[model samples]
Each structure stands twice: as C-alpha cells, then as structure tokens.
Target chain A: MESSRYANPYQTGFLLGLLLVATIYVTGRGLGASGVFKSVVTTTVEAVAPEHAANQPFYQAVVSKHPGASPLKAWLVFEAIGLVIGAFISGLVSHRLTFKTECPPHVPTKVRWIAALFGGACFGIGAMLARGCTSGAALSGMAVLSVGGITTMIAIFGSAYLVAYPFRRLWIGGKQS
Target chain B: MMGPFVPDIITDQLNLIVGFLTGLGFGFLLEQAGFSSSRKLTGLFYGTDFTVLRVFFTAGITAVFGVIILTSLGLLDRNVIYVNPTFLYPAIVGGAIMGVGFVVGGFCPGTAFCGSAIGKIDAMFFVLGGLLGVFLFAEVFPSISDFYRSGAYGDLTLDQWLHINPGLIALGFTVIAVAAFIITARIEKSVNPDAPVYSFPTKSHAAFAVAAIALGVVVSVIPDRQTRLLERATSVAYQQQHPVERIDPQDLALRILDRDNDIQLIDVRPDAKPGDRLPDALTIAVEDMFGKGWEHELAATKKKIFYADDTKPAIEAATLARILGYRNIAVLDGGLSKFKAEVLEVPAPDHPLSFEEQMVYDFRLASAEKIKKLIAEGGKKVVKKRKIKKVQGGCGL
Candidate 1:
C-alpha cells in the first residue's frame, strides 16, 4: 500500500523561514540542535555518573553552573524538546508516525538501530569537542558569513563526502540499484 | 548586544515559561519538516534528499534580510543586539570536530533533542554522549585552558573587524544565498529532471527574483561603518575636546565653613523622609531646586552654593551645575549607601537615585552575577549572560 504521508517541501521551508525569523527576533540568536544535545548528555552523565562527568572538561562547564537546575532546562534543550513535539505532531497529523525502522535494503532493523546509536554517540562526543553542530555551524555560520563558520561547513561537508564512500553499503545498497 | 527587545523584568520562573513556549514552536517546526529521521538528516551527504539544505538556507536568508530591513527603517538598533565572537582557533577546531559528529550521529544537538522528544531511542544515546563530551572538555580544560582564553578579543562584530558597514556584509551574504539556491536548483534538475514538484506560493518566479535583487541592493547601502577602533578613537577625541573641569570637594567644604555668605545648601532628596539627609548636608528635591529657578537664586552671587546627593546625584548636579554654572559641583563617591555603610551611625535604607548611580549599580550587579556564575562553572560555559540593572525614575530614565 502507498504511504499516506507527504508534505509540501516548499511550505515546510517557508514555515521554517518564519520560525527562524521568530527565533532571531526573540533570542537575538539562531536555532541550534547540537549544542542542546550536548547539554543533555552533560546533565545526565553528571547525574548518573557524577565522577566521570566531573572529570571531563565538557561536563564540568554546564553542570557546574546549573548544579541546581536540570541540564534539560537549557534554552536549546527546550527548543529541541519543542522540535520533537512539533515534528511528532506533524507526523500524527499526517499519519506518518510509524515505529518501523529505516535501513539499507539488506540491513536488519536491529543493525540499523545499533549503527544509529554508535554514530549518535560519536556525534555527541564530536559536537562537544567542537562548539556547535550543523544547524549552529553550517546554517548559522553561513548566515553571518563568519570565516570560521564557512570553513567549518566546508570541513564538515567535505569530511562527510570523503567518508560517505565507505558508509554507502550501510546507508544504500553497495553496487546495487 | 544582539537581542531581547523586551527586558526580563519578570523573575526566572517566568523566563523558563517563555523558553518552554518558544521551544514548543521550535520543536513543532522541526517535526513537521521531517528532521526526526536520521536518514533524512544524512541525506544532505547523499544525493537523494536536499530538504535540509533548502529549509536551512531559506530560514537564514529570511532572518538576515529581516534584520537588515528592520534596522534600515529605524525600528531596531543593530548595536543593541549580540553577535557571536569569533575565536579563531577554538571556533575552527570545535567546528571541525562537530562536522565529524554530524555524519556519525546523523543528528546535531537540536535535531537530537527533537528526535529524542519524538521517542527516538538512539537520539537519547547521542544526547548522553554529548554530555560526556562536555564533561571531558571541562576536566581537560586546565591542559588547554591557555588556548581557550588566549584569544581574548572582547565582543568583536563583523562590522567592526571588517571595517565595513554591516548592511554591506549582509548584502553580500544575500547575493551568495540566492546564487547558491539557483545553482542547487539547476543541479537538482540535471540530476533528476522530473524531480517532485514543490514550488513556492509566488505568482511568478520573476517577482521573487526581483524582490531578492531589491533586498540585496538595499542591504549594501547602510551609512556608518561601525568599528571598535573607530569608536575608541571617537571617545578619546571627545574626552580631549571636553576636558572634565574638576572641582575639588575640599575647596567647596572650606567655602561652606565661611558661613558669612547666604548660601542655600539644597538637599536634592527632599522626598527623603526623616533621617534621610547625610550628616551636616542639605537636601532638596530637583523640583524645588528648579522651582524658583536655582538659576535665578544663584545668579551673579558671590555666596557659595553646595549640592550633595548620592553617587548618582552628580549627574543631576551637573545639569544644575550647567544651569547655575555653579562654581563648584561635588558628588559623594559612596553615595548614601556607602556613607551609611562606612561613616554614618544610622544609614539611610532608601538608596539615592541618580542616572549615573543607577548605571553603576547595574554595571556592578551584572558583572558580579556573571563573575559568580563563571566561577561556579569553573570556566567551561560557552555563552555568557550580561544583565545590567539601572535605577530609573524620571521619564528619561
């Protein structure tokens, strides 16, 4: 059966444009996805494994200041939370909120989830080491034309391209249509 | 100096409520746009999906253009908004590492939050890993603290650093965004000529193109090229031109001792109830001071005129000084609070209000709070909050 879910990309893009405008108007900043994720990780590790979190420079930064407040209480965290609710709401409205997993044609659902977890963990570590992620760096950076931002965007896209070849079998079937 | 048109007069609880409300809007948009899926996020790397690229570019262009347009109309002062400081090394290094993280994680921090919010279990682990990374950075800060703090450029903006008008820079970016969009569209078509049609609501593409060109032209024309060095130079010139006429308080004190001249020592804060006046000092409200024209009272008189208020009173006194052209204008450093704390037996509970005094209080409180928070974080936090509170009473204030 044909999937009953589809969105007009142009409308979505326009809506996102409005959302971004609102974000800048209210916060005097851009929307960021990675930074908030790092905050969550720091807050959780600090709670569940205080010693390990304390020992790391990254965890010490956020957790130390907001010792009393929840790590999830960050602006980015709230924004991220909103993102999920928004996306899910859209999904439900469109009847696209499925539990089925996505993977390469030959990969098992379990394997795809495992790879996602591994990749996600690495991304978390990398995002912390760097100050921002794609949304913060590539998108926001390009907006202001910060040389660093542009350079980072280049590095990111370039690196991804270089690495995509090896990862093709995982995402798309290797040597197959 | 970037944002929040409305001040945060409300308490922290209220602030969080606003944050949550805004987050709801942010989260809702991400989900609607299909960022919850890792495959879609990673699609930018692959050839199949360009949704992320299109949405991201469009949003950025809209905001950049909005700021430029608003500033041009005098609705917003660009100077009051905050711009991210460029730390040459840390920013570059941090950004590179993050890029690697993006492909690996298939979800940046913001997307991860959205994914986790929608019950993506792997996104949760990504969040956990990010926290671990932050912890690690903090623990190892001492080893690399020097590098992080070494780039001590205090709040430099592109306009200041580039010695160009921000409007021009904005125009350049707009042109680039449009160019990129066109190129991407062409590439998408060549790769898949029968691409799924998702056109915008414009009546004609030509109208959109003309609008984009008009915006680009307007942004390239802002007048002042605001630069840090130039601002500093202007201030130095101002100070040089108007050397502060210093009047020794001791000289005025000795003049008061004469007691021969009929001098009306006005206590500025007359609304100040009993026990309000500083010991051996007079008090007068600004209205009373100017009521009968202190200008007329002290006109062509040889008698000494003395005015004392809190630390802030000096500003008011300056105005009165200019009006009366008082031979001497003296302001207490500690104000009433300091006087009560340092010298007075019974200190005044109500603090004196002056424009300068308010600024001083604001600057001190904001600085003190920031320093305390920074110390508590032990130097790992990236974003710094600066909230300066000033005492305001008059319509001017």
Candidate 2:
C-alpha cells in the first residue's frame, strides 16, 4: 500500500490563509484555540468550586465579561468542537488513524508520555499568560500586524530555538538524528 | 453590503456558525500540512524539516495581503476589525514561556487538538496536561494577575508603532517571508543530506513570489477607500465637477416652522455648540460618513440638508454622501452662519422698502421669533447620537 503523503506546505498554507481572511472579513475576529482551554478551566472551576470561583477575582473577571451564558457556549468552544471533527475526518481519509505513542527508537514510551504531559502542562500555563497560543496570538496577530501578537511570535520561536539543544534527547535519542 | 456583517447584517448566532466553518478549515489545513505529527512540527527546531516555517510565513503574509486588498477595494471596513491589544512585558514573558512549552510539549495548543484527533496517545496526554496547567494557573491567578496586565497597550499595530504606511510594512514583510523561505529550504538540505528533498518548481515559485510582491506594491500605491474618497471630495477639480445643490435659509426656516417631516437636517460641524443645531437635525461628523449606523439616515426618502459653519464643509459632506451613493442630498446655502444672519437675526432695511420686499421682510421677522422658540423647545428634546457598534474580539476569557 502506498504511504499517505502530506499536502505541499505552501498549498496548505495558502488555503489556511484564505480561511483566516474569510474569518476576519465575516466576523471581524481571527481564529483561536487557547481560548477553548480557558473556557474549559473557568467552567470547571465554576462547577466544582462555585463558592471559590465566585470569590476569586480571576473568575469574577471572566464571569462578568461573559454574562448570562454558560462558559462552554463560547465561540472558541464551538470552534474547537469543529476542529476535532475536521481533524478526525482528515485522519480517516489519510488512513493515519491509529492509537499509538510516537517516540524516538531509543526513548521509552513511558518517558515520552511523561515528557508530553509535562510539555502540555507548560503550554497550558504559558498560553494563559500570553493571552493566546500559536494560532491565536502569533498567526492571527501577525496577519493583522498586532504588536503583541508579533512579540509573542518572536519570543515563542526564538526561545524554542534557544532551548531546542537542551531538549534534543527527547526527540533524537542519545545520538543526534 | 460591507464585510464584517456580524452583529448587523449577520446575527451573532450566524457568526458562531461562521466561526465553526472557519475552524473546520483551519484544522483540515493544519492536518494536511503535517502539523498533526509532533516529529514534523518539532523538526523545525531540530533543523530536520522547515515545513512549519514555510506554511506559517506563507499563511501570515497571505492573510495580510488579503486584508489590505479587501480594505483598499472598500469591501471591508478596517475601523471595526479587531487588532489585538499589546501588553509589552506580558507578551515577551508569556511568549518566552510558550516557547519553552513548545520545546517540551512538541505541539502548541492548536496542533495539539489536531494531533489528538488523529488518535495520537501522546497528544491525548498533552491535552490532559494542558488542562491541569490551566487549572493550576487559575488557582494561582490572584498572584499573577497583575503581571499579566502590566504592559497594557490598546490595539497597537506594528505599522502604527513604526510610524510608517501599512503598505510599506506589508511590502517589507513579503520580502522577508520570501527570503526566509529560500534560506530555510537551503538550511533543511544541509541538516539532513539523506532526507527527501522537496523540490521547488522554479517557474511557479518565482511567479508566486512576484505575484505576492505585486500585491504589496498595489496596496502601497492605492490609498485606503476613505482617504481616496476624502481626497477626491476635497479636490478643487472634483468639487467643481460635482456641484452640490443648495437650499436658501428662508426655505429652510419655512420648513422648520412647518415641521416638514420630509426634510432631515444633518449637522456636520465638529464644534457645534448646544442650541446651535437646527431643529430635528442629527449630528454626524464628516469622517463618520463611512460608518455603519447612518446608512438609514443617508438613504432615507427624506431630503438630507447638510450644514456646517461655512459652505465648504457642508459641500464636502454632501459630495461625500453623493460619492457613497446617497441621493437627494443638498448643502444649506451659505451654511448656518448665513442662516443665523439672514433668518434668525434679520436686519431692517434703512431705505423705504418696496411693498413685496417689505412683506417678505415682515414675514422673516415673525418666522425668526417662531423658529427661535422652536429651536429652544427642540433643545429640551435630546437627540441621541447614533452608536456605531464595535465588534469584541481577543483570545482571553
């Protein structure tokens, strides 16, 4: 069987760009993902620790910003749902759907899983601080030439490059690929 | 209909639908570009692949060009579009932290969603970890909240900061993007000699590069719709060609006394004092002619009489209205100054007046008193300024 191939980078990028343009033109806002995580965190807190959530300034700010609605009923939340569906469809068509852990040959699956979790945790905290993840602040912000967005973009990639050497083992094992 | 129809033409509910559809496209494109794979995404850091750079730069530049073109063509309103607010320290610090996250996690939030959907177990764990991180942040929110909002700069753009035309910035970005693409492709080859070489078709790639640059040039050459129209409206030649119809103060006074519902008075003066406004007149700035709310007033069947301190501004406003496709628009001849002198403060003739002239002068004297009383009464009934709706947007909760 022929292996599934990725689409050309430039072609995919152009399509993504057009989609963003359409999004901005129609809704007057850009695409976002981290906001979904924010919604989830806020809603969970409101549900589990209603008293604490009410008392907390952070929760109060969020609640006041979006009054008279469930946090889950946000625009980003709906977009995230659609994102999952779209990715699932793409995976199905490409025959790349498999329940497997991807790690370098020398790296153990347990180690990779731990690393992934730690990384995800770090991303979650960082996105909250940054006001956006890559898609939201960086890409969307760049299209609009937003100063904050561009600043974050530079910091994320620049820092990633600076730190990549130290975290080399996680991807390439003991011997560099 | 202009773009960004949300909350006006496109209801909030429909806007959500638009969001979902766009998100679907976003996910599909990301997955197709191999962003669903951690190794492929992380490869940019390792120098094994530059797919992320290529795709990201291309996409960003494309959208920038698209926005500029749309705005230049008058299909979109730049004013209402949301530009992300800048917080200097938060942006830099948060970005640095996100960078660390990217290196450790192997996927940003967006790619993580796409990655997990493809049944990647590591991605699922990442998602769970992300949730924990956010929860932890919320728990410790009070401590960090101040830092988060420390460097608040509202809706600032790079062009504004640099104090350059947006077109020049766009052009510079295009040049930089194209250069990065070429250089990155070369770096990718040197890093892994045995890796599959992605051939760039010379003709098509060059053509696209040229086209992108051409768009930048086009944007730089053509001013935005508002500026272009304003320039044309104010030009001596254009004004001469498009002479606005004018109504005398006597006619306007008579209409005001009669309370003519068919005529709508529009005060375009920037510094119009209280009680200076004509009765039933709505105040709309000349710049605000392009905004959304005044469409009904401008397009109404009732005649619109634009007035300012002098005839120049009123003529300019009427010409702008005409240019924007409004009809039955006329300037108040000699403006409010003329009206105040002729109608409100009519002077008695020194010489004996002809019978017809005396009768007209007597009519003006009586009408002036009635008009003053009507204006005084109209002042008590406040005319609310039309609010132009601003669309709310950001990544925050």
| Candidate with the greatest lDDT versus the true structure | 2
DockQ of each: 0.38, 0.78
Q: Which stretches of candidate 2 lie over 4 Å from their true place?
A: A1-3, B194-202, B293-296, B349-362, B377-384
What are the chain A TM-scores of the candidates, in order?
Answer: 0.84, 0.95
Per residue, candidate 1 scores C-alpha lDDT tens digits across B1-397 of 1233324333445545555666677666666666776777776666656667666666666666676665544344444343444455665566556655666667666676667666676666666666556546555666876666545453355556788766677667667766766666666556544433233443554466567668677677645322322242235454345333433433433333443354444445545433444223344445333222233343435433333445445335434443433454444443555433433232233777599877756654554444334334532332211323221100000
Question: lDDT per model, in order?
Answer: 0.54, 0.84
lDDT accuracy of residue B86 in candidate 1 = 48
Compared to the true structure, candidate 2 yields what TM-score? 0.94
Clashing pairs in 2: none
Residue-wise C-alpha lDDT for candidate 2, range B306-353, written one tens digit per residue: 999889999999999998889999999999899999899978798999
- Taking the candidates one at a time, how many backbone clashes does each contain? 34, 0
Q: What TM-score does chain B of candidate 2 reach?
A: 0.92
| Best model number under DockQ | 2
RMSD of each: 14.6, 2.2
